[model samples]
Target: MQEPPLRELRCDVAVIGAGTAGMAAYRAAREAGARAVLIEAGPGGSTCARVGCMPSKLLITAAKAAHDARRAGEFGVATGPIRVDGVATLQRVRRERDRFVAGVLSEFEKFPNEDRVNGRARFVARDILVLEDRDTRIAFGAAVIAAGSSPAVPELLAGLGDRVLTTDTLFEIPDLPRSLAVIGGGPVGIEIAQAMARLGVAVTLLDGGHALAGLRDPDLVARANALFAAEMTLHFGTKVERAESAGDGIRLTWAGKDGAGGSGVFDRVLAAAGRPPSLRGLGLEEAGLSLDEKGGPCFDPRTLMGEGAPIFVAGDAAASRPVLHEAARQGRIAGRNAAALVRSGPTGIATPAPWVNLAMVFTDPGTAAVGETYDPERAAERVVGAVDFSRQGRARIMDRAAGALRIYADRAGCLTGAEMLCPEAEHLGHLLAMAIQDGQTAQDLRDRPFYHPTVEEGLVTALTRIIDGLDAR
Candidate 1:
């Protein structure tokens, strides 16, 4: 039998991966008068909108609600034993996730300048791509590799059977296990362990390094540790040697902080050991593109163009540390630059603004920070401001007094970084990130009026402290 003919199509920009970044880039390209085509690996949506961020957050909220209900008596509310229907809660989360994904798909369908293709895409050349749908082949023009990363499952524990689950497959679990051993101390592992523990599952979180190492604030890390300690067992400085299936559970052999070998058995083993960018079989080498040491496509920082101007990379596939917000920002920039390249022919600079702000959202007491952490060696003088949540009226009222807001600036008052571990830390962190990215000083945040009695009001108070300390000096 003869092979099917390749379907040829032309567009000003071709965005591969329909995740947050791909969608943003597609829309931006269309707005810039470029006909865009969006290609996705799975379906039309992404794990972020479907199972990753949205569903996981919903499950976390449900878990938190169940936990609060059990403690209602302490808040002067008479309540019986807290009950949680894990299956029903999961169903609701999936439903909402589906709706959100469908809404995004609907928006893509409505765009006249954007074409959505469902298939696995590989490079035919630098600028050309061949998308495979079973036996059909479709080609495109300029390509954007937004192919995001997947849950990193270590090779040592790969042979473990059904008991082993990654973040992508955790939501599909038939029922909540009696005990869960979460391997990895990063955001995904911590969040999953905490969520499951709150849902009444006995959880043990093991991380090779200290937990929340990226937070860079000892006090914030301690606060998170204390909060997590109330529910789950956290084993820091623990390395997983291997995993084997036991009778009804899985046995994990690990090295403890003292370098002693220890064993743990759990009903299920969740591998939350971060992610590796999805770059396999994408023909990157055929297109003369190479990945960095961090497993992301190598690209010029100024242009974000890898190998050639016709091929661009963004999102998780391009970034060393792929955060959703950063991916979207890079995607928009890449899309605009790609369109500009196609329109104006050869250009030196693709986009003027590069991705600068990176934010991470943790459920409940989340955190956000931008720019570099204060380094004594790199600074002539450093100014640090901090205010405990216990002093914040809203935090006290909300009964969440574990976190704080801290800001770091230079002697000249340029915002270097800010960390908020409050109830609304995630949102408040964005404000700080914007300020720092915009080169705003502590006075800018101090002068901004926050809503009365809100968690964000703590920002103003924290900045006031920084200003006062400066004046006193």
Candidate 2:
């Protein structure tokens, strides 16, 4: 029997993986008047809604309320003993998560039917993608890959069965664990550790690396340890040795701090270790793409363009900026560029404005970092205006102020970046980002009026210190 002819169609760009970045790219490409088709590995809503940012944050908010209610005595509210129904809390989280997931699905529903392709896509040619399930071939002018990422489970922890969890499955539980071993020091690990702990779980946070939250700033890392340690036992510089099933749980063995050895059996083990790009089975080599050391398609971080290929890689797959906002921004940027590359010829690509990149961790006394930082090696060239919130007015009133606000600038007093573990730290970093984006100096931020006794007042104090140091120098 002769092989059936391959089904073929043409489009401006074939967008693979319908996550945050992929959806954004699909819409942007269409609005740019380019015919683009989007292929998703699964249903729409993506990780953020289904499991990550939204659901996790809902649980965090519940945990925060529970913790705060227990501490009502500090404010002389005279509330009696408090209690939390963990199952009910989880149900609420699921309820809200379903709503968020539905919202994202609704956005995808508005897409043109011809543009949405549901199947696994792999490149069979330089510019050709074949839907693995139905043998539908799409020959496109260009392509955008935003396939997203998966939790990086360490080799030792891989075969531990259902007891091992990631952010992807952490919320599936009806009740919080009695004891949890969180195996990472990244944002997900730290945030979830604190959340579970506050919700009445005994959490032991372990990190293979020395720094927490991937922060290398010695001072900030120290502050995070001091704060987060109060809630859970945190071990750094630890290497996992083994794992095995233990009475409906998992027993984890590791070399503890200072090369000491220890082991523990936990009700649950969460591997918030890292998020490596999910590029398996994509047949990237067939698409004429080279894989980098990080297992991502080697693409220009700024342009999102594959080296010498008519492809733009965005979102977690690009491994440039994994945050949702950054992913969406990358999607739009790559989408517009891909459309122009196919519709009007190659005109290159544009990157985001300088010094606009930022990151945030939503924990109690949350932390945020804006601009280029987390380095102490180049501290000499930078001035740090640090304000300890231990004595800050609003923090004292709220009984939640126990971190530092460190703002950085050059000798010229320009606001380059800021890192802080404080109340509403996310908002402070964003406000400072505006100044940095607008080319405002530290003095410029200081001149802006701040309401009295607000957490932002601490920012003013730090900004004043920066301006003062500039004058002294």
Q: State which candidate has the highest TM-score.
A: 2
TM-score of 1: 0.92
Model 2: how far residue 147 lies from native, Å? 0.7
lDDT digits (tens) for residues 25-118 of candidate 1: 8877888888888887776666577657877888789888987888787789988877778788777877888888898677767765438777
Off by over 4 Å in 2: 1-5, 351-355
Per-residue lDDT over 68-130 for candidate 2, one digit per residue giving the tens place of the 0 to 100 score: 998988888877877789899999999999999999888888888988888899988789899
lDDT of 2 at 122: 91
TM-score for every candidate vs. truth?
0.92, 0.97
Per-candidate total of colliding backbone pairs:
0, 0
Q: For model 2, how many clashes?
A: 0
Model 1 regions lying over 4 Å from their true place: 111-114, 133-141, 374-380
Task: Give lDDT per model, in order.
Answer: 0.76, 0.86
